[model samples]
Target: MSRDVVPTYVGTSFHVCSDRAADISRSGSRTSSLISSPSSVRTVTRRQSTSANTLLTLDPRRSRSPSRTESGDLIVRQPAKRVPLVRRTQHEAGPATPQSSAMSDAAKIQLVCTLGPASLDPDVIRKLDARGVDLFRLNLSHTGLEELAATVEFFRRHSEAPLSLDTEGAQVRCGSVVPDLVLAQGAEVELTADEVQGSADRLSLRPRSTFQALRPRSRVGIDFHGVLLRVIETGPASARAVVDRGGRIGSNKAVTIDPSPILPALTDKDVAAIAIGRRMGIDHYALSFATSGRAVRRIRELIPPGAHLISKIESRAGVQNMDGIIEASDAVLLDRGDLSREVPLEEVPYYQKAIARRANRLRKPLYVATNLLESMVLNSRPTVAEVNDVANTLLDGAHGLVLAAETAIGVDPVGAVDMVKRAIEAFERIPVGLDFTAPGAETDGALLTLR
Candidate 1:
């Protein structure tokens, strides 16, 4: 009536030892109790294996029964049949291995999308969430105080991603225009501080001091240089400029002046917007045109506790004092659009590389904004150069990418986000081959040796 029994369950313990004969001889009568009768089941313990095929295996087929030793102890071998391998998902596989961790870190590169008329609806926000936006930016320059609360509430109602209230720092902008103003090259136009709807003959510029500060022969750029002008005459509240480059200009377009005027860090509207944001429990603020560490510290005082301060480097002064600004703020954003106005357009790439390197060295997050996918705003696809620029930005150690017009007013906001997501994933798949370090970095005791 004795039958061989083999324990199929993994990690099971047994009363019998491997050296059954010697153990029974030494124990004498104790062996009788341990073995009892052969009719009693004799369990064989299973040692755990790392192999996927053998781990957690069970087979009921008795293809090969256990064999009994001279001492009546059973010896176990392979189970009756091998269990099919069970695949595990990332979560079921337990903690991520080091190799997997390295791959996942690249996907963590943040994507910030500005919420505007095109993408501000709940359905659009949800679609953007699905497309993988880490943050939704509320550009105060475009959002009036009356609409601030409703906009913040709209985002909270639909998306779970964090909200970033972007302040309208010190930059001067044009007021409302009845229709698009078309500036013809070589035409004389009057830049006035009057808050009237703009026309081709006269454009309204905000912050009268900036208008008065314009001197004869000073160059000006509007709408990111869509139109360029040179001041011909200066007045108390207005200046006459001759259009050097002509383009159609719209409402609320940025006006950049060379020998940039000295203005306060936070404008009156910015302060009022901050109050609205605070009351709405907003904890993230992006300071535009952050000129110095002092400007960052000043706004840091107005934000809520535990709020993140992202200082934007967009002006000559901001770039000159980048080290201090990056050190003072929680994160840094490089506005290449405005920056190009201050520095030669050709030098923006160099600035991007330098800023990215410095931010990486300091262990601070750097987000690059402007023109990442400008063409995507109108077309369904991005240009090849745009895609390459995004890939290079990631290679430069940018922690995030911000899409302003692309997602804010683009025809295909979701498509734009998908493009950025693909770029990030593609970058993650690249095999890390070289270990780059600063020129003066100490080579001794380095974790990774440059090949």
Candidate 2:
């Protein structure tokens, strides 16, 4: 039997009764044994090794040398690998037939929709909620407290989905630039210290005081499509600079009048909006231009404890301090509109990926925003690029995607939200770098895209 290892084809495996032990059987040239307990398992194999002689004595070879030359002793005891217990989420604990945990995490990616003129209807709100829209963003930049409170009331009465109020942080904007002050090749645009007279329909110029903080000739940028700015010009009432390139500037739209936004977290407008948000039971507040943890802390000091804060990563400062700012807030929103203004346009995608990865790691839900379907505002559809952008970010693990002009003032608000939901679902199905089985992973993170 030990001349050489031969192919042993098993015919019938006989199982022992009441023993729960599976072992080799050899009534012929094979082997058989009964497995009992740890108490008996070592005994069975130990017992079998030496006991082989007793059985072999019965063999016709009657005392021939042991048949199993190098064959190791049988020990049918699998260290009883304690099957690890799985931790289930709340939804799993419910009656949903225990869907794949992968799908479950996908469902957890908080879907936030911005509400405005286009999406104000009760039915539309109900539809959005049904489709998994987890939160509604009220743009405090445009909607005053009264309007916001009313919107909040409508949302509460219509659905229990959460609320995120976005407060425009202190940002510089172009003062009145003669509504259509078109600059010819040689024309000069001036920001005067004096206000446009009453006939000019403008308020008097006031010093922001922080502007004094600027050193002479530092760059003061007023950015829009692409940033066209000027170096500081020293003056008595106001400063003068040329719009190296020109575009239409409206009254109070926003002027970097200076280098950085020189104000604190809670502007007078923010304070008022926060007071109203508290009264209205808003769940979260979005702080634009969130520069440091201190900015969120300042706003936190003002809002009621029930309400949380989300930092809007919109500027160079915001991106540079993303980790600290994200640490300070309950959530984060990547506002690419202002963000593009702050970073090189080519770099926004990279920023989006980095920010999403950081937020996902911290277990904080993140929102990607700005022109995500901007084209859909007028057209009923999105280009292939816009579609892929949403999917890529979803693959990147973004918790939500925000639509500003697409939803706020878009011609078809409900349609825009529907489009986003579809894009998300489509992306979720596409194969990506995600191993959904891994912990803390969902379809929204770098889905194995070709870099």
Candidate 3:
């Protein structure tokens, strides 16, 4: 007896054609063989009256290839290898189709704002959010978990934005000094591990490792926030250095050394910060002073599965291992503040361009951080140089721009964000096809491209 067969379609119907003899045989082997043969298969697709669906079917035996219709429907030929089927549905009353790639490209430049006293108000944060602030960064070096817990709770309660916790990674700084030391140029001072009330003559540097790593002739920048010192003598527990550039050095200020000394990638404080951040449901962590893929991997083991990692490259070692670090990180940040201290200040722009190029070529997001809008920290308006700097950074293919101290402790935090937003808008206005080449730009070390 001949049998009728039906093929299933979601809210649709399919008409199958088969030989009467094959259907009447009713033998399982024959039926299977008939169904498996390409020549014996014929299908007619029918659309439901209630819905419109576009289905592209490929004929395995047909030599004539399929082509597109004027209505924008695509027809594909069968491939040598098996290809998965795709279905597209169009609804008359549904929302328009989303162009995800275009939307992503349009908003590729992210704005990261650091939250502090000035920006902690709900009104300020909402304004920033409306202006396109993508994430809020918390500096652990300045605030502990206890203090940040309230901020975290506030964000969770008031906003849908994600938070990024930045660890104070292996930073060396001056400890408590009884009297802030005044080291004049050509004067000598001792950096010791011993806990002492530091004077102009002797200053205390904790972690002892910093002292052990010092050698004669080493250049030490005491508080780039303050003075510059050069080592004249080295000791087991202390190093005697002369002030190359003189200024008053105060307590709790950062120190930088040439050929950056060996220090732990993550400090004890950093470990504690990471633990606290994990508990606070932080979505991202910025690993400060990241130098290698190994260090990033170590950090990865600590963060939760879905949390993103941003590696801040702020040292020569980090520049040297840029490829590995970028490969291992979800994103890279060019922290110009600490980085300028390590390298000559004049070399910062070059390094920024090189790093930005690498990041762009790899398609990894790069954040140009620090000093973008420094003037806005105090003034209601940013300087012309600062505006140009912001524009050029965006033109250099930076995926994001970070507002550090400008937002963290600035007098006009919202104004700073607005200024940056305007800069970004101006950058976007530049004709996409414009040539950005400058005089001697090819040799000037800036990455210039014709988009």
Candidate 4:
């Protein structure tokens, strides 16, 4: 016999047993019913106020009671109480100074931190939330749906902070390296499309297209800018190169080939992540390696309504297509780490200002991510330079700051968040006159003119 499937709100279907029906009897003008199913047997009390269409299910065995009605039917009743949804607010500590008081009511900067082993503890997450982390980012690049679901559920149970599902969009990286090979300067190496044991001489480059698109004289960066390889020859399935710079390269580290438009904007893993995000009720999604307005629209189709889409600008193509991407996306993220590989190191600041300017002009939220506090990954405090970078990013009209490794694997996740909050507090101390001509000014000049 075919089983009747019952759809649930939790994105899963369960079979319902319909073979047995409830037997109703009247005892002293009171109606009692014995509801029997394959799962459990329960007694339901009939009330004049109870709707006829109401469906009843037996409570779990642990919660079941031996109470019965006059007709000897087990007594069951619908729950009379429910847990109310209460919104939790973060409390800022310390004595409120003139600067802190002025900035307290001012527009607050949103802080987004990536989740990992370092910040997985519920108590740690609670501390981070209380310290003012507005959202938690789940990087899908490192974990799959099963693991992601559990993590999301845990956060939902423990805190009120929303989740941002970050997709590993079309970003290519080295798959595996054997023995953690180290390359010396002027040494020849091969980047092959096939999965093989990587040595100092050859490494595995997945997606295959990255290898096929290579040309002689092209540069390849390995291990997050650790080493550089200059392509000397290209073939159908591999490219031969010489180590321009030497360093220790490990397995699963990111690899960057210069001029990265050859990579796709969306990958199969990204598609699966979107479906899971929708079911999990993710508040926002950060699309990595975004390059064009068309790519943003395609991802929008997959995402459900009410969820914000953030386009990560991390490549030369993404920078060139900034206007279109900003227009299409709810927000734009400046991924400085990967973007530095596409453009000159010195030009990253210029690109950041340019992108921030355009995004602000369009009234779109701009997020500055990556290396905001590199020192804090190991240190308990941020260096002056790192703090200055965060302050300058805020001055550039960024609406948010994204902490990746600093909070994901850092030694002090709470300290990193506290530092970011202090940086924003410090930036707001500079009092400036409002300009109405500013496209995305927080307030109109007329409002301040009366003062």
- The per-candidate count of clashes, in order, stands at 0, 24, 1, 0
- lDDT by candidate, in order shown: 0.71, 0.56, 0.66, 0.67
What's model 2's overall lDDT?
Answer: 0.56
lDDT by residue (tens digit), candidate 1, 20-92: 2222233341222222234333555555534311212234453333233335665422111101112112112
User: Model 3, range 1-451, lDDT digits (tens) per residue?
Assistant: 0011111122332212212112222322122222333432334343432311122233444321222333434322111111111111111111111231323233346789998878888888888877768778888766655677777788666567777888777667776676656788998888888878788888887567887788888888876555888998898888899988898777656688764678887877778777877777676888888888888888888877757788998876787777788888878899988887776566576567557756655556788898998987888988899988886676455768899889888998889988888778766543232112434534652222322
After superposition, which runs of candidate 3 have C-alpha atoms over 4 Å from their true positions?
A: 1-104, 154-158, 176-182, 192-206, 232-239, 248-251, 435-451
The digit string of per-residue lDDT tens for model 4 on 1-451 reads 0011110111111121111111001111112222222333343433221321122232344322223444454432221111111121322211112343333213467788999879988988999878868778888776666687788888777787767788877677776777758899999998888878889878888677787778898888887646999999998888899999999888766778775537677777778878877787765788888878998888888888646778999876787677788888877889998887766565566567657756655656678999999999999988899987886676555778999999889999888898888888765543222223334333432111111
Write down the RMSD of all candidates, one decimal each: 24.4, 21.7, 21.3, 25.2
> What is the C-alpha lDDT profile of model 2 across 155-237, one tens digit per residue?
78887766777877756544444545444322334455464631122222223443454445555544363335454454554
Number of clashes found in candidate 3: 1
TM-score of each: 0.72, 0.65, 0.68, 0.69
Candidate 1, residue 356: how far the Cα is off, in Å: 0.4
Of candidates 4 and 1, the better by lDDT: 1
**Candidate 4 wrongly placed segments (more than 4 Å):** 1-105, 144-146, 176-181, 194-198, 232-237, 259-261, 430-451
Tell me the lDDT of model 2 at 171: 64
Error of 3 at 15 (Å): 60
- Give the 10-residue window scoring lowest on summed lDDT in candidate 2: 18-27
User: How do the candidates rank by lDDT, highest first?
Assistant: 1, 4, 3, 2
